[model samples]
Target: MSSPKQRHLLRLGLSCRKISAQVTNSATESIVAMASSTEQEFMPHYRSKLTTFPRPHRFWDANIASRVGEKLGFRLTDIGISDVEIEQPPLPTHHRKLIAPFLHSVKRAGISVYGSEKFESESQA
Candidate 1:
């Protein structure tokens, strides 16, 4: 007979396996949706990137997977969306705006520069 903690660990591992299966299936569906009707399609390889990382839902670890799903334009599965809210990127508006001009200046000096005329046209468009 296993200890309570051991039993809990076993359950958690099983749950992770189930979640992986679901995500893999979902990925396969996504690939099918994107594939052309007559084209040979590649199999979906849904690697469980979150398994090794600490479970975000338990005791409120940050929801990295959830954020990733959001960025990828997918719904976070029940297992993916943890109780904890993900950490948000800081809005360094002043610093970002200051750096923006410098970055643009550097880009303008490069071979692939979007020159002043192109920039003005694009902005207008």
Candidate 2:
């Protein structure tokens, strides 16, 4: 579900498209250029995400965090969680067993651990 702001923006976009159709060539050109430039500024992020993972949900791993941080012009440490650290899932399967003990210790120490996948992207800001 989108926020009210997002819904408003979508409405504004629809209105803009209607207006653009009735606008002069120069006005249309300007609007098109502005939209293109905005897209270009955000292109690196979109491309990196597209090439790295099929969806944002894949960021459950530390590797994705590092890659995403690099693409977003930020440090992996800035996003929290070390690339070497892995979170154990709720059920300790074969793969989860590898990190289960470590996660249990971290939890017992009262340290909070989070994955990028569970949170919204910075772009939303």
Candidate 3:
């Protein structure tokens, strides 16, 4: 929903993940971790290896829960869940690009700052 990058990444990643999702009376959080081509290339194969099992793979990462469905499907059963809690880092702010202006100010000057040892000064801590 954000941009075309999602489509490209998903195609290369080849997920059964839906392009659009709806949650009913539930709060949802999205977490995006850097996905290397190597990881993308192997995720499908790794997931395929565990399709027959109804529970999480023995080595399945707990942090990647948001993007994985089948690995956590066993929690849906009537057996009940234990020792799991939702963790969040507070809600996001409206001003999304907080550090961009600082970056722009630093690089806006025409002079190249890298290797400019002439301007460097030591400060005793």
Candidate 4:
């Protein structure tokens, strides 16, 4: 049997075309994060979430705290999580010094560098 909220949603669903699977996991994570951050200040609520995924890692760990949890503020040591140090992941440097020169030389020699940021050459003035 549909609960009141479910029945209400069903009625709305007929009038809307934008239906998709529910956001159950994210919603639950947010609930937990909010409960955890009740007495917080300084960090904005949205910033507390650690949602950005930097590209360098070969694997993603699901167990890592949610973005909301991160935004809510966390102390890794107190959380009993570890490493002697903590640091933000390095961001990618999209520009390469050699890439511009290499591309110029190759195109002059009639070779085209193609596909992906790492190999693709950008034009420099």
Candidate 5:
């Protein structure tokens, strides 16, 4: 059974397949860029600004999704899990920059970096 959100998206003319194709094309472009560069070329050189850590759940869900997608060779959207929204506080800009390369690599590897700021913004819109 489709979730209400999924049905709503479908009703609005964005089918899952269309969404998947769009995401896949965007990911392919990034993957191609990544393929031409070494890891060090893409990673930012910055010191982490985090002085305190929050509870694990704050980051655990996205981390787990990335890892599982890596292992399974499928993004969350690949298996109709697109509507599972997770809300998280925005990360500091420095933190985002520090992890941007890692997240890019994850996406390049065919995993969805869920709960990212981009996703959050789009979901809210």
Candidate 6:
């Protein structure tokens, strides 16, 4: 029998593995090609859409953003939408350090981050 904390950690680890498997199975091409190819070739302009989430101000938010980006091919710059009403402090360096490992893991799994320009042209069209 495990302690509550141990059980929670097990669950988290399992979830992470599931997500990683899904991303790896769905990987379409090399990260380099995905990053450099014109957006039209991979994602049709008419079908492209931008989805925004709250600005990340915490380590957890950063983790969520990184995972979402990996799954959807959205970069940090692509998903950020400023909210003047909600003024949050900048993420601490410690939090950034915590998020780095996960981001690197996604890269290792062949997930690429895409620039905002990918969506900008789509929106214009």
- Number of the top lDDT candidate: 5
TM-score winner between 1 and 4, please give it: 4
Comparing 4 and 5 on lDDT, the stronger one: 5
Q: How many backbone clashes can be found in candidate 3? A: 0
lDDT tens digits, residue span 24-114, model 2? 1132222111011123444555456556644553212332222222332222223332322122234323223222332333333332334
Model 4 weakest 10-residue run by lDDT: 7-16
Per-candidate TM-scores read 0.17, 0.19, 0.17, 0.19, 0.26, 0.23
Q: Candidate 2 — worst ten consecutive residues by lDDT sum?
A: 8-17
Global lDDT of each candidate: 0.22, 0.26, 0.25, 0.24, 0.30, 0.28
Residue 11 of model 5 has an lDDT of 9
Task: Give the higher-lDDT candidate: 5 or 6.
Answer: 5
Q: Identify the candidate with maximal TM-score.
A: 5
Clashing pairs in 4: 48-70, 48-71, 48-72, 49-67, 49-68, 49-71, 50-67
In terms of lDDT, the poorest run of 10 residues in model 5 is 10-19
lDDT of 3 by residue, 61-90 (tens): 222322332222222122222112221222
What lDDT score is found at residue 82 in candidate 1?
Answer: 15
Instruction: State residue 99's C-alpha deviation in candidate 1, in Å.
Output: 1.3
Kindly give the number of clashing pairs for every candidate.
0, 0, 0, 7, 0, 0
Candidate 3 lDDT for residue 109:
26
Candidate 6, 12-44: lDDT as tens digits: 111211212112111232121112112233233
**What is the C-alpha lDDT profile of model 1 across 1-125, one tens digit per residue?**
21222211000011221211012122232211111111121112123334536543322111322222232222222123211111123323322222223223323322121222432233334
> For residues 88-107, what per-residue lDDT tens digits would candidate 4 score against the true structure?
12223332322233233323
Q: What is the alpha-carbon lDDT of model 4 when measured against the actual structure? A: 0.24
